[model samples]
Target: MDLQKRFDKLKKLGLCDRCLGRQFARLGYGLQNYERGAILKESKEIHKNIFSQENIPQDISPKDDCFLCRGFFNKLDKYEKMVIAALTNYEFNNLLIGTRFPQNIKDKEKEIWEVCGDQYIEPIKTEFNRLLGKRVLKRLDVTVEFNNPDITVLVDLTKDKVELQISSVFIYGQYNKYSRNLPQTEWRYKNQYSESIQEIVQAPFVEASKAKEGKFHGAGREDIDVRCFGKREFVLELVAPKKRSIALKKLQKQVNMIQDKVEIFNLDFTVKDKKKELKGKRANKIYRALAVLSKGIEEKDFKKLKQIVGTIKQDTPQRVSHKRAKLTRKREIYKIDYDKLTSKKIDLTIKAEAGAYIKELISGDEGRTRPSVSQILGCEAKCKRLDVLDIEK
Candidate 1:
């Protein structure tokens, strides 16, 4: 049918101009369906076909329900108010709008597309999204984000409910753990001596971000008895934070106050993608361990320790096998240098691949680790104190 015929046929079915205009959505540019519908209703061709000037109004109002939308476009104001009210509690600069329409609404849309061929007519969801975003920008003075929106508003038209999904605010930094008893995160078992690194770090951020909860993400973990001397990478995520703007320096300073446990530095605002990147990275780590020997070690023992280099196979340590799956992992010991402190004690500096259990590499973990310090020296050995010196990328 021609434009005039299609317009006449659609108007006769009691569809509002907004609903009628959407049927030919792609036919023009720069004007909305409401504006296009008003233009068509007042056009010379439409007016000539319908009635006289005085009898015809400037705008075409629906006499009954809209054939396509069933008066959905008319209820945009109500849905907009519901979304706006729901967003008042959150502090967001940009947002994306999502919808949950009733099954009948979707079925009606499909029916129109089947008859109209989907060439010019806009999808009901597309129209609703554009209309809602435009109104939100005008009323709330916020930007419509297509990617990485600060907040995502879901309008459930079926249940007449609104839900706000706020993205977690990430803070990236490096932490130095001074305490030996502190775990990288919370352990299932409690330690009376000290708190976990997560508990110490998250408390300050939760209060600073004004968020409901906080989680800590470390690049890799250290044992409870191991101390981190260098800056170990980490990211802290604040979930549904009301205050997104907080000084990184201030956050760093506040977190460092618990100096007895852990001190975090280089604090800055980061995104969730950084968490994935950090996790994907595998870096070599330098460790200095003070080990105790069961017997006296001669000068020849240092030469024997150097021979314990290269690819060493290690099974999961018996101490952690109950918690971790039993699997043998092959890790390289790039270099192993030692200094004599006493006949029974030696300080060993090791440069090894990531995930190479240093303590197990020293003790041999009852033969689970091959060519270890104890296996090389032909005597029993155990790591008394371990400290991570550097993490090389």
Candidate 2:
């Protein structure tokens, strides 16, 4: 039958174009239900004109009530303008638009589909996103990003709200924490300090690097008590950056002055593609730990540790079992050097695996860790302080 007749029946029950077109979903491509309904309405009017040899009655007004969309589909221009205004503060090359509808609207659409015996019908979300996306593309002139969009404009029609999801800015570089007692990322407290290491580190780097806010991603992390001494590989992902290129040497110098513990090295610009590749790569690390013995030990026992240096069987430490899987791993000790600082304390230098649990290796985790410094020497050895001396790629 003609859309006017169908509208007469569907309108008595109340139906939107998005709702009406959903019943005929199998027809057309790249077109929303409202657009499809509009086309169907126009075509039906044209058909009546030719057949009856007179103008068909304008029985259905364009502003007729729609059960599903509630006539909000006609408000596309207003929503598009809102999105453009929301995006003004951020810089983005690609964007994706999303829409959400109320439960009642969806329920009404479901009722219509059921009445028509589940014929081809488009979804409410599909029509909303597609129509809004098209309008945004035409008005804003921004490309759509499927995998990693610079911005995601979420149009929540259900509550009449709009939200902008901005992607983070990315920067690849190496960092060296000259001093100790700082975490690589922020440390959160339930009732205390809420800022993290990244917050402190990135603010200066953002100003120095002349980019948006930055997020720090390192190949690995050291204990909060430990300091990063040499070149530590890191990637800083900036979010909605205003500027990209900056003087790296000067920025590095500026970073050094603010926090004596943190410094950016090998500063370079990088794209999103490079960031993914660096995520899986590993780098060599050097650690210097101060070992304290329960009792004074002779130099002879220390030499014995050097003998078995190259062969160390390490497994996942028990202290980290809550967060890590239980698995046994073997790592070459590379080398071990010790300098006598006192009778009870000695400076120990060790090079091992990238993910090695260095602290547990010294304390021995109550015999769970075998061939440990305490196990090998038959002495209780504990790490008083640890420092990451170097990181090499």
The estimated TM-scores of all candidates read 0.90, 0.67
Instruction: Give the alpha-carbon lDDT of every model.
Output: 0.81, 0.68
Q: Any runs in candidate 1 off by more than 4 Å, and if so which?
A: 1-14, 38-67, 190-194
Q: Write the per-residue lDDT of candidate 2 for residues 272-309, one digit (tens) a residue.
A: 76666766766667789898888888878778777546
lDDT of 1 by residue, 74-96 (tens): 77889989988988877888899
lDDT of 2: 0.68
Q: Against the hidden true structure, what lDDT does model 1 obtain?
A: 0.81
Give residue 136's lDDT in candidate 1 (0 to 100).
77
For model 2 the local lDDT of residue 145 reads 81
